[model samples]
Target chain A: MQERSEPEAARGPRRGRGRRPTAEVRADVLDAAGALLLERGMGGFTIEAVAERAGVSKTTIYKWWPSKGALALDGYFHAVESVLAFPDSDDVEADLTAQLRAFVRILTGTPAGRVIAELIGQAQTDPELSAALLERYSDPRRELAVRRMRRAQTEGQLRPDVDPEVLVDQLWGACYHRLLMPSLPLVEEFATSLVANLLRGVRA
Target chain B: MQERSEPEAARGPRRGRGRRPTAEVRADVLDAAGALLLERGMGGFTIEAVAERAGVSKTTIYKWWPSKGALALDGYFHAVESVLAFPDSDDVEADLTAQLRAFVRILTGTPAGRVIAELIGQAQTDPELSAALLERYSDPRRELAVRRMRRAQTEGQLRPDVDPEVLVDQLWGACYHRLLMPSLPLVEEFATSLVANLLRGVRA
Candidate 1:
């Protein structure tokens, strides 16, 4: 396992708390950070730049994210979490079809493609950032997908022989590769065809 | 296709140079660039670093690559072009299984993982770089794999209904994902199981 470490912090957290901070303020800060990250590549961006973009005080930004990496990390989580949720349905094929297509759409159509590419790029260079992404960000989605696949297996819709972990790697890997090399169009028909073919081996 | 505007010279050779560089010097330069890309990450290193590491002068490096990006691009092409060459054999199953296993091994066991991740990351930020890698680096492999699968289909090894492109995408995607995610151990077992399952789906 790669060693996990905290990203560089801009400053230590506030020593004491008074009503802490509002949820709205945190959301605003994260949104600002996300924009900055997308606009300026990670290497070029700074804590003060994030503060300026968000129009929030540096103290407020520091209070929330100790380092620029942490802030970018949070921004990534907030931007991606909602999109990563899996769809549940009684019909495994329908559920998977929807989920996978939705995933391809988000990753390919939106700026999310560029964002993920950047994160993966940084992950190559930064062990701490890589570990955090795998643990905090990627792990959750992988677990969720695995759970869905396992449930499908138990329900007799999927083959008992299919390994949830392997399937997860296969599905996500396919998506990541497409994101990296955007040569082919990732249309719904393509997604349906892919899911059907993958399931043939995976279904019991 | 992404616009393929990379000057041929920018990639490796400038046809009409006064004196063609020696094979030994070219290989030395490529080795140096690859090492630097892996050790310091692309952003942290410079052309001078490559020259110093290779024990070659700056003039030697510039004579070959005009910019730092060009050096990295050529090095990546050299690595992938060498690595992505699939072995030829009469038995379809044996050939693909060996090739896929070899592909996984090369990506994980060597610094190729870092190089690819870096290339993808750069592609996200730079249009020209992205186009160059896709055209020069990624597409050839995809075409080769697809051609092999299509041949399998003709030989009655693959299901007639299966899309060769999708099959190649899934196989390469799964392998690429495992390579980039450091936590996953690139075991032969996973490769074997993945191929077995994939064939199960592909076989008539």
Candidate 2:
């Protein structure tokens, strides 16, 4: 968490002598933002705090991200990017099973679940945050999964008539439902079951 | 909406002389609460307003409902009860399709969608509300659908190994995802397609 920004903090006041790459600065800010959000939750997340921790200017952050919600979403995505990455395999079931398992692990084990839950909750009333969530997080993630499913369809692993968008919904949406409703525990087994049931069909 | 409460309001100060039936009084309060929620949302929904509108005592309302959120959920359910009822036709697919279509109509056509969204959003921060939503609303609704699916399984209409609970999530959860995220439109066709896709399976 602090590892990325620590070096930037140590190099304080030497801005003019050597400017960091845009990607590096962006990574540092997002890392700091994600760490702050995970540690303190949304109430403690502020642009000022992120700027200070990342050792970057507030103006720079605003220049890159439109709003706090946007920044928070980007940071959250950045933090979880590696873990939630969609995998492609010859067997669509294997790939989906792997990805959904990883997703359930994050939702059940990590602070990322709570963070995302809060973000979705807050987005209900906040238009800007809603836009950011849809544009930056949900849409991109859905597209990635949809893309994978599309490839599977081409490979004749999935039914030609199946709507990949709805498949995405049936699988991931079930997980999201458990996350939001909480009456059911979101276990990894549920993810595997979701894939198996969808693929095999429920018709006897 | 106001039809249920208008007569009660007209009854005014005649509380002690001719006390209304408990069931009738309960109906009036819930009607008032639902109407208030739909019209003004959670922000304007209050015990006092409901009491005044329903011509019931505050004590009676509290005795029946623990909190504003609980009242709102009950009220919302009462408002949409007839429309969202689960059907038990001979064909499981037809029953599911009919129920989901009705559910989609409420979500898209009425104010219920925004009201539930607001309730869910607030529930994230309010434990009491979350409990009310689960116990009084989500859990019961889920039970109804699951029972219907379980019956289908026993009748050999559904796969024996299929998890009814997961099936419920896959269908209803997808609708909720669209409602909460709003990146996709929640249409009647989507509901029909959801039932069809789930019944037939998505395998090639």
Which candidate number would show the highest TM-score if scored against the true structure?
A: 2
- Error at A80, model 1, angstroms: 3.9
Write one digit per residue (lDDT tens) for candidate 2, span B92-141: 99999999999999887877888898888778787888889899889988
True contacts kept of 1: 0.45
Best by DockQ: 2
Q: How would you encode candidate 2's per-residue C-alpha lDDT over A20-121 as one tens digit per residue?
A: 888878888899898888777777889999988877789989989988899999988887788888776699999999999999998778777788888898
Query: Residue B19 lDDT in model 2?
Result: 77
TM-scores of all models?
A: 0.74, 0.93
lDDT of 1 by residue, A133-172 (tens): 7765677777888898888888887778877777666666
DockQ, Cα level, model 1: 0.29
Residue pairs clashing in model 1 are A9-A66, A9-A67, A10-A66, A10-A67, A159-A204
lDDT of 1 at A50: 68
